[model samples]
Target chain A: METILKVKNLKKYFGRVKAIDGVSFEVEKGEILGFLGPNGAGKTTTIRCLLDFIRPSNGEIEIFGYSSRNPDFYKSRSKIGYLIAGSNLVEQWTGYDHLSYQEALHGESKIKNELIKKFSFDPKPKVKNLSTGNRQKLGLIMTLMSEPEFLVMDEPTASLDPILQEEFYKIIRKLSSEGVTVFMSSHNLAEVEKVCSKVAMIKSGKLITVQKISALEGKKIHSVKITFSEKVSKDLLVDKNTEIQEEIPNGFELSVKGEMDAFIKKIAKLKIESISIMQANLEEIFLEFYKK
Target chain B: MIAIIKRALRDRFIPFISYSIGGIVLVWMYIALLPSVQQSQVQLQDVMKAMPEGLMKALGVSGVNLASLEALLAMKQYNMIWPLLMIFFIVSFAGGMIAGEVENRTIEIVLSSAKSRAKIFFSKYLSGIIYLILFVVATTLCAIPMAKLYGYEYAAPNYYTLMYLSLCFGLAVYGLSILFSSLFSSRGKVYGISGILFVAMYVLFILVSLKDSLKNLQYISFFYYYNINDALIHNKIDGLSVFVFLSIGLIASLLALIIFLDRDFAV
Candidate 1:
């Protein structure tokens, strides 16, 4: 278990506004760590600090046991790839020109053509002529082509169509399987949950919790819907973690916080026609953290 | 750094060629017309005699003979047309260099690379200097062939002094443009602010030249050191002038490097 990146008490402030207030996290090798937060939740800020695109107001980031601010970090940089949201490419040149240029910078590419074929974007067309999604594809190729061991992506799949998004996921899956580490930020909870080994939920520039995807199972509440054959008192379920959310003529929706086995057995004793138990998604879990 | 220079060159190369063509036209028009203008020199001098003394001095034509090909070409080509072309070239180039990248959100990608901000800034600045030399050399080369074809009358003008002045003057304006570019994030604002500053400086230089009491203002105006006709016609390379312009360029670029390196890139 190699700890490739370590960020400690990171704080970045714009004037008086603390963009990221004392965020601390670590990413191990070959793991997909999802940085989950809403729009201004310091996700991009944290990534920018990690990449040294901007200096942190206070704190430090270690990349591969070296300070991220090290003058020789370039040696480590060759092992890292990043895809920026709304990438800026030379519009006058074709996508291949950008690919060749970046390849030259990072040395010869091992996966350039493979990623191109996988993403399916025209490399011959001028960048100005490429669609937003295609430009995103070109950006993806530019970053992934070097076959870097680590990837820091900021909403890499936002502009792509659903099919392309799936393609991006497949590529990430393949990359992760090959033992490449990834640190990505996304408000796309389902996609993050589907692929991320672990998630760090952040709100208002503070880390709420870092949980394994499975650990979220009982750590947060799940919403449950039950329809009874007849009107019944809310007391039919005796579990304290379960509370009726919306009452219906014949059914009620309950928010269940923890384990539901006790609540389910109690509800089963009462004649229930049908029951559907729904688990809270990552976004809901995040909202709960915000409330707390 | 190499990648960035390639991209910057890709962006600036076409416009540079077009400007060179425009420069060629100006150089050819002035030099190719020199022989004929020399023939009408007496009449032209006569026509110039009636002009008011104040107007002549303001136009920088006082004590300058329109009869010599050197004087006429120096006034028309070196002082006015060539500098104008160089000003636009350097201003737009410097304006777009880093500021353009920042505005387009492209600097983020470039910054993500292993290169330092200083590396990026210096590489692009060096390319601009190369372009400046090429542009100035091209114009001078265009003039030499045409002057030979047209049989330039006066003693072959000092090519070295002309080139030196052009480089110095180019550096001066280029420095201001890059400074403005580094100061502003928006590409258009870079151009707009530098353009406004250039015009203001040019105007101030004119007013300072016209008013004996306001001559001290020349210290701030780049156009003050950009006396190309004085440098060419007199064969006088002012060391102070060269130092001032080059220093302006180097100092401005230094400030740009400092600010660019230290500033947080919002992109």
Candidate 2:
């Protein structure tokens, strides 16, 4: 697959404070890459650098094969769509005014009406009068109206209701299927996991890891809790990858990584009353990364 | 670019029309009183002679013959009243040009488009120039028709010179305010800095005009370069003054664009 966005060794500093430290990642064509981080973890800073709104103190960003530092990089913006986290719309302007301005810049948006209907946004009221959720809906419609090749959003669904968030995910999925590259930052791990194919985790201005969602879910980390009728030696299930979370008189809560076959066989030799195995979800993996 | 300009002009439409009509009516009302003032020229001259030279200069009525309609209009309209009005409008309008957008976070929307920063700056700057021209033209050009309505012999060339000087002055004020606008994100900061700067310059101009020993420092004030008396009464357009105004305007505007292009919109 072709890479649509590339960030390498990116560092941004405000005075002596490093906002983004040696962060690097890539998004391939037609891929939905979710940028996951806590508040002030350099997600917005990285996005700003990617959009060339702010210059990086070190390293570089390349979008569509053009260096972001290039003076002509603005030419590539025509194919990019952006949605700021909050209501960045003009307070005095109606939704129609914003749409008309965008249409004037690019051609008329063919899917403008469809996105508005899907979001159930009313474009007649001035933005100042719109509620926060309605304002987010308008911003979402604006980002998707032009049908850009690459979409960069900052906390795109931070204010959307659950149903609207689900609808937004469907639109993102549909857009990705049509070969649109999406890179969005969100603290909502569930939202990211629902739509994004890959996730890049960032913490304290550093990238923890970037991996496929499926790969993260298939990490072979499982929580096993076994209640045996009789007391068993803790050494019986001894394995390098297995961690005993809790010790009881007749039970053990084990967190096993990788294969469970040997542990299952070992436990089978002993009498077991009840056994429960729960697979690790993305949230658990995210928490583990944060803990580290 | 045109759309951006249109949006800017549309946003400022109410203020533009209000100020234009206010300026025209103000000029016309001052002209309406001209005939009576001219009729009492001797009495006014006596009163001017009784006033101290320093006080007269401070009032912008000392250096010129008060008998002339142009001199009376310059003293009454352009001297303190009209400039105060123009400064208020320029500071409020140009202060919001760039800083207001950034403060409201609407600049991100504009920057998200394909246009370069230069294009956006010029588009908004161009809208301001349009308003400035309209204000200056409406206020200055009406003097000719207004004097004609009062049956006073007024020179058209004098008002034309006034228009030229006024445009340059407006541009200078606009440049100063916009430069501050580019540097600060808050419109209130822009207003405060530009307001204090203008007040200082006006005070300096008044001091130099009042005291001959302070004459050397007169050149520091834009008010000195304005030379409204020469433009109106003498029908003289000083090339140096024009150059200074245009230079300040161009340099400030250029610096504004440069700073705006390099500025990082934090969050």
Candidate 3:
């Protein structure tokens, strides 16, 4: 796939605070790249820099093959749809009014009705009267209606109800299927894992890792619960790969980090009646990554 | 640029109407009260004594004879009322121009569009000028009947000249406020600084009018542009004052545009 966005050593500072520090990443065409980071970990700052909302203190960003230094660099932004972290619609205007204003700005009148229906938003209600979920839906509609090539959303599903969240993912998936590149930032690992084929983890303004979802599946750690016939001696369970996570009267739980074959065989030899192994979920993976 | 002007008009039309009507009413009421004060046969000195110094200063009373109805009207209404209205409308309009977008977080969306920041600034400033013209026209129309009712035969030329001077005053204040709006990101700061600058200039104009020693300071105040004593009462427009006022607006607007083009917007 061709690279859609290339960010290298992107750094931004506000006075003494380094908002984005040496962050590097690339987004490929037709790829849903998930940007996962905790609060204040530079996700929003990175998106802002990408959108040219704020100038970077150091480093470079090239979007659609144009360097940010070019005077016409912002023209490339027209191809990207953005939903900033917070909902900032005018309170006095109805949803329809706001959408119409934005449509006028873009000089497009084709997608109004389609987007209104797609997001299931009530156009009659004022923005101040709309609930958080509906407000997010309005923002989503505005961004989506632009028919942009890439969607750069900062915590797009935040403040959304579970049902709306599901609906949003469905829309995102639909867009991805249509060959629109999506760069979504979120703190929810499961949300990103559900929609993204590839994920990059950022921590404290620094990128920790960028890996494919399939690669992470292979790296999955599992917990094994073994029920032995008798009390297993400490000598019998002498394996460094499997660490005891929990101890019971008749059984013990072990977290297997590496290969599970040798540990499973050892448990079988110990006259274990039953054993259960479950793959660690995304939440656990995030915790482990942060713990390290 | 047209789009920006349309948006500004849509947003500020209500405030513009309210202020324009309020100005007309205030001027009419002040004129009506003047006849009553005159019917009571109160001494001019007594009337002046009844008014506080702060009230006179705030009302921009200076140089004109209070005995003549036209001079009284010029001092009480034309001299300060239009200037106050011009400053209020321009400052309030300008205070909200860029700062309102920042407050609403819509600046990002606007900046992301095909239009450049300079275009946006110029368009909004031009819209402010349109509103200012509307305000001067509204006041001029309302003042015509009031002038006839008071039997002031010279009101036509004076009112026309005052409207022209108000336009110049509005342009200077509008440009100043736009400069303030671009310099500060916060709405409160923009309003506060612009308000203080306006009042400070008015005070300086008064000081220059009160003392010959301080008369040179008139060059510094935008209020000098609409000096009714020289323009309406004396029936002579100070070409120097008009030139200075227009130059200030041109320089300030250019500065605002330059700063707007280069200044980084907060996300």
lDDT of each: 0.80, 0.87, 0.77
Clashes of each: 0, 0, 0
- Against the true structure, candidate 3 has what lDDT? 0.77
Task: Let me know the DockQ for model 2.
Answer: 0.63
- Candidate 3, residues B38-126, lDDT tens digits: the string is 56545765666677664454354433456555566677677777677777778888888887677667676666665656676778888
Better of 2 and 3 by TM-score: 2
Candidate 3 docking DockQ: 0.47
Off by over 4 Å in 3: A84-86, A224-277, B31-42, B45-63, B67-70, B145-151, B205-220, B224-226
- State every prediction's TM-score relative to the real structure: 0.91, 0.93, 0.86
| Complex DockQ per candidate | 0.51, 0.63, 0.47
Please, what are the lDDT tens digits per residue for candidate 1 over residues B139-240?
Answer: 765666777777765444565677778888888788878888887887799878877888888788778766778978878887677766676678788788
- Tell how far residue A38 is off in model 3, in angstroms: 0.9
lDDT of 3 by residue, A133-236 (tens): 78888888878877888999988998988888888898888888988999999888889889898898888888888888778767757887878887787557
Which lDDT value does model 3 have at A172? 85
Number of the predicted model whose DockQ against the real structure is largest: 2
Residue-pair clash count for candidate 2: 0
Best by lDDT: 2
**Global fold similarity of model 1 (TM-score):** 0.91
TM-score of chain B of each: 0.92, 0.95, 0.86
- For model 1, the stretches where C-alpha displacement exceeds 4 angstroms are A218-220, A226-244, A250-252, A260-278, A281-283, B50-55, B154-157
